[model samples]
Target: MNEILDEMNGHEFKFIYKTELFNEILAMIEKKKISMENAILLLKCIGYYATLKGIWVSDFERSLLKERFEKMIKNEVKKKEKMNENLLIDL
Candidate 1:
């Protein structure tokens, strides 16, 4: 997963990681292993790894990336909420 992430460019990397993390959370949900709230919170932290790349990204860029990551996370959470609502209705 890290290799795949490394191969992606900056903009692409954020989207890809958000997708992969969302999928992981969905799997955990399917397995009845995690609460929806926790899964969503974990998704929000997926971009912390970017901090470790201090040498690669400038402070300004990192801040911008963090904002973008937050927006991506918010969007993912909204998607999950809608899906959960549908699932509940189906049940």
Candidate 2:
């Protein structure tokens, strides 16, 4: 019983730690301290860890993350295109 309790406690601690790490990553992204590419990499690592831990993520949650990543990539592409257009106009 004690061993089981200890194991549960450890799992709880890991869950909390992972949650905090996720929040920190979001804060860094909001502050522009990390690039979108790096953020995606970090998120992938987080997801991998969660998967290895057998933490079940709902399909909706997965879809939301996917949508967010796609949106960020699209926005970055748009920004680059706009910059290129501006350069062409200037030329």
Candidate 3:
């Protein structure tokens, strides 16, 4: 994930981390290769990078990563919202 910290937008990183990283991450989550807690930790780490280098990192490659993140986070939010609603009903 040092790549994530690098505030560059080269095509090399585009392939290495942009196109491939999220797929590997999502696959690991799906396959239970990573725990949900760990996934959140990873996301928070990325979020930290983003906080520091939002404008610097958000070039072509970062936009591609954004598209994927938008979709994934939307779906995860829906699931969490549903779970929260259920818990409130139980309460």
Candidate 4:
């Protein structure tokens, strides 16, 4: 749990692609209006599905990922608030 939180605190998302599927994923993210972290998590899950054949992602992994994603968003929000406060004070 701590490890997950740590990773989320400094997570960077990137993917390589050149297909309609990539555009579809972007469309869904935009439609949902989700955070970048959520979009990256979803993309990771999608990649797992596309690459892995018979192997399956366990329910445990899914649950853990969801929890971590939420934590990441919360942390980001807090950071943004702090930055906004500093900006307001400067202005």
**Strongest candidate by TM-score:** 3
Q: For every candidate structure, what is the RMSD over all alpha carbons to the true structure, in angstroms?
A: 11.6, 10.4, 7.2, 14.6
Residue by residue across 20-54, what tens digits does model 4's lDDT show?
44455556655776754566765566445434433
- lDDT, candidate 3, 1-91, per-residue tens: 7664675454443344454575577678778999645765776666565555543333424444346556656665688845544322321
Q: Write one digit per residue (lDDT tens) for candidate 2, span 1-91.
A: 3343235443563554444465566667778999656766655554555565676534324343445545655665688845544322321
The candidate, 3 or 4, that scores higher on TM-score is 3
Candidate 1: which stretches are off by over 4 Å? Answer: 1-18, 47-91
Give residue 61's error in model 1 in angstroms.
21
Show where candidate 4 strays beyond 4 Å. Answer: 1-18, 27-32, 54-91
| Pairs clashing within candidate 2 | none
For 1-91, candidate 1 gives per-residue lDDT tens digits of 5676455666664545554455555667668899656654554344444544432323323343345445656665688845545323322
Cα deviation in Å at residue 12, candidate 3?
Answer: 8.6
Instruction: Tell me how candidate 1 scores on lDDT.
Output: 0.50
In model 1, residue pairs whose N, Cα or C atoms come closer than 3 Å (at least 3 residues apart or on different chains), thus clashing, are none
Q: Which candidate would rank higher by lDDT, 1 or 3?
A: 3
Q: Give me candidate 2's TM-score against the actual structure.
A: 0.43
- Greater lDDT among 1 and 2 belongs to 2
Top-down lDDT ranking: 3, 2, 1, 4
